[model samples]
Target: MSKGKFSSGVDLPLPVNAPGVTKQERAYQAIRDAILNGLLQASDRLPSTRVLSQRWGIARGTVESVFERLQLEGYITRKVGSGSLVSAVIPDSYLKAVTDTRTGEPDRNESVEIEETPVRQEGRYRAQVGVPFVARLASPLLIAPAEWAAHLQRAMAAMKPEQMCDVEPQGAWVLRDQIAQYLRKHRGIDCRAEQLLITNGIRHSIDLVARCVLKPGDDVCVEDPGYPAVHRIFEKAGANLLYAPIDNEGIDLHGISDSAECRLAYVTPAHQSPLGVIMSATRRLELLDWAQRQNAWIIEDDYDSEFNYQSAPLPALKSIDSMKRVVYCGSFNQALFSNLRLGYILAPPELHHRILALWHTIGRSVGVSEQLGLAEFMRGPAFLRHLRRSRQEYQTLRDIVLDTLMAEAPGRYRISGEHAGFHLILWLSPDQDEDALVREAERLGLMLQPLRNSCREIDLPPAFVLGFAALTRAQARNSARQLARLLH
Candidate 1:
């Protein structure tokens, strides 16, 4: 029989005595280890401090201190009605360590089945439309600032032998601080270093958030004709998917209201994915209010926000989130080179610990060397100069493409999403099927993505996405001409 008496509702193990560790530290470590080892799964309610104190023969303050520490570390979460519960952030290292400890001398399979791979038919025509000009692009891959290179070299040289092996699962503090500052100044999203989770790219950030917030069978709402990659992520996570309609003013929030099943929604309000429509300020507020009312989470993927040409980019959803219902995500892949693979998420203060734990579990932290280099780049004078130059260059190329297409194919297509990002949308006439047009364009040596490709099976349109960022003015003009010739 246990020595402690607990309230009838409170169920917990009697805390064991620690030989050398303090009671609070012992309790903290025990709970943390339980969570890391999967002994305490997500949503598992924790015992009250009073019960724990009674069980351990320690003061209630010590147990309270333990709970506070665990909460701070993101290993546990506290809600108004629900006491402390084990967080959903699974430490990947703990799982790996567990697997290594298991009896692993498995019997080898005698025969492995070989599957036949499907062969792709060769296309006769290949043009430089809607595709990155990787082959024709200049050397060194990306034209990173000289200061970035210098900082990277310095970081590498300064790394000690053991430091080299240290896996910075939370990313470099210097870079995280710089990113927080940059977001505040440029995007109007004020965030602390602790609230920012550095990731390899937008996709990784999306994956981490999904893993932490969603369980299998949970429904997630995404914009119709939204980012295809996000759809893939949700599907891979076994989420029940829902779609909100999109229009010139951005996502049709009314549709979201009609669906009561979804607890999560993904919106690209700065520039709607594939469509290029910006959500109006009124709509943005409405959406936020709706999210708060429903106790739903909104993931704001502000991709390609830096290249706004028509007007200053509107403040991100995160910037105005008083309820802390929005998770703002962004990437530098579009602004810089796609290969850079750097992105970040600004989570709510409540989610900071869980997200960090998720980061540690997934081992998905951005490279420390690259993070330091990026920090230096953003801090140095060269980064702003590069942004200004790239903005001008992309704007010029965008204009050339739009001009050529409008002049040559006037009534054939309607342009959208030219205000920001490297990509634009060309809405084809109802008479032309988008996939057929794409196939025809390919036959004429042009590679184009059908806008319908970004949509779900039931929702599609006769349109295509054209990226102009990586292309030169001449290339844009030529690609536009080729597209016109193919369509007309």
Candidate 2:
């Protein structure tokens, strides 16, 4: 009497009892049940709509309707050439079946092989460099607003159709406009949106610039104890690196000019890496003049200039670049999160199209959704509010760190470069073994860096670069205590 069968293969439910259910509905329910009951598996192709229609004595349109319903319900997936397949949503009973088959133990219901993620332990003390924890922490913690999220969601939904087709090789124009406005307001670098070429991040931006400008084995001047990653990138691009030593003022232009074969120079003039020194206005003018005279390009990495603790943010090297010699690179990696991977290059107007072409050959572009979200974020009132909040936070943390060091270590450590950015360099006594101190500090639950590590060779008068931005005031105090103990 029943058409539906039970586990024992005996008929259970009478098909006549379900009078209102259409034949198409019946087919859809049967296929869905088979999928949920573990009879059909993920990736198992289903019968063609025509075959099923013929076998079940239903119209082809009706079968097509059923398959479409199944697809909408996530019971099946359709591929371009490959036919519809069973979806991978396993029912609770099917999961139980899997566990039962593997161990033959019926009572074990817990999900096996799922390991707990370990908690990130906060270090008591640290002196690591090359990261902008202070500049980041100084900025107010702005969670992306709901409107931003909504914009991203809408963009992503639209991207489904657009992605199936081709996108612009340069980048999304809307994002370029947004970035241009942001840079104009904050960095005072005047440019059209068309001149900007977006890349994966600062490193990728550097690669694009290198590809556009330099040839293999061409000599480029890099600051001594400069960004190590920059050196690697230059080498990979086939450039012979020449060292330009940095002083308290910034990269020594005299040393750079003296290099016989140095054709280009990379400098973090706004705020030097590791040293935390700002290139004075006088030196900046001199460097620009030198570059013009030498017919060389200046790669000004204006990283972390946004969180200037002492004074108003310095004008970027590109701001005064009348000769069109500066390839200005900056990023939200420090201002926002590191993984954002959105950095930009402002090449001279003449080089814009060339860099754009180079970017197209390297990678497609950043994700459409993220670009849209960032564009919306930059236009909003929240961004300005966040910037103000970050400035105060960084300043407070900097003060707390300075006070702690003065109270604890006193004359033992000479603190330098606390005027801007997220860290200060501590020059230690000559007798101290910088490497040994760092290793011992690590064992005692402190993360520190030896000044020598930043150098190509050994450095005299051991020093450490300490970052206080990621830690709270209380955390900074506690870390300072641990550092004081380590030093003593």
Candidate 3:
């Protein structure tokens, strides 16, 4: 795909990403920009699709489509072997002379159409989420009941004419206030609405934090058996992710190099994912001290912390941050349903404005209807009732699974991390192979997520992450017996 004699002068610029614009749109704009700015003169040769695609890191088909579009719009012409050449006359009449909408004065290169889809998606996207709550445990109801819909209707109906055009990047103040109150009353996190920035979910919050706070090559300490998506997020953000292993105390701080100049630590202190070990009080302070000493930040993901069976869950890691090094994130997706698509970050006061600015820049906020409806709901008893209902329901499901497993499996396995969260750990005997057990479970039509699947490198004792939420009593019993047979 060499450009022959035209390779030297051909300068195809890369796409500049605009919020809500697709990569194809950006690439189109890039080529058009190259023409309008005189970087690509009339009659100048353009590179082959392969060359342009390789240079732009876009798919070759995408580059070809852009070329086709350019040709369609009278911008480029292609010959059999000479490749693409800029048209003798580029379309500049409208592009060079865009009129200002307010004053009717000639504007310089400002008007371009980029199709943007709705950023905030809300509503009962599914009847149930996570554990298939409706199908297995409760009546087949959506995450939101009829009451929620009525509230949403009222919310939308109540919007004033001017309010329809409002944009709240930090999200509606009412929702933030509700979240603040909820955190204070339920999670023991003392925070104000002013310090909160609404997000899509914890994943989105983590991504923003990494992009905003971490620079390329900055070392970030993450839990080894942690959320796989988050590991990819950090890597994508150009941060060097160091998978710090977890122990009964939580993430083994000693394993993390004290002198590596780690810029951040990501931990689920309340309920360690997959393993479900609450960070001991001593370890929490030690982690805080480590962050303070290293001048690093901590991302406390309070996922599934809402459900604790053993005792009252500890306050979030941010609850006792004397040095304000922790950025607390929580989501209603797990608390309510996965499709809620709403979460918030309690950014440290120092980082609040930065995170908020980034939030606004990305236009990642829930829609007015969802936010307003949720605000109203959280302001009432229904939200608390929902929590209570879910807690009770999960506890029932937990009991069923426990009874069935205890009866069926007996002494073949040990369970941990069952005190909180929907999943529990089934620690297999050392001689049992995790992969073999997983494959056997698959063969038996039972879902068995190996604990090793969550681990990055360091080996953990053989175990299975037995998630029982999506199972009914019968299904649970059957699966338990199947697992018992496999283990025995």
lDDT of each: 0.67, 0.66, 0.71
Give the CA lDDT, 0 to 100, for residue 385 in model 1: 78
Against the hidden reference, what TM-scores do the models get? 0.69, 0.68, 0.70
Candidate structures ordered by lDDT, highest first: 3, 1, 2
lDDT of 1 by residue, 1-488 (tens): 12122233243443466454456655655675565555666567777887778876789988877776556334566777667776544434334434544545321211222112111101211233235322211212235566457877876777667655755555666777888887876776767775677788777888888888888898898888777777889999989888888876677777555447677889988778778787754456567667655667889998777777865455576765655678888877655665577888877655555676767765654666787777777777766677778777878887888888788888888877787776788777887766776777767656676667677734655777777666656667887898877667
Query: How good is model 2 by TM-score?
Result: 0.68
Ranking by TM-score: 3, 1, 2
Candidate that would win on TM-score = 3
Error of 1 at 294 (Å): 2.0
User: How many backbone clashes can be found in candidate 1?
Assistant: 5
What does candidate 2's lDDT look like per residue over 101-219, in tens digits? 55756432223221122111012122232222222232223445464477676656666566545465555667778878877755657777766766767777777877777888788
* Clash list (residue pairs), candidate 2: 134-422, 138-390, 138-394, 139-390, 140-390, 217-238
Worst 10 residues of 2 by lDDT: 114-123
Cα-based lDDT at residue 254, candidate 1: 74
Candidate 1 deviant stretches above 4 angstroms: 1-148, 158-168, 257-259, 431-436, 457-461
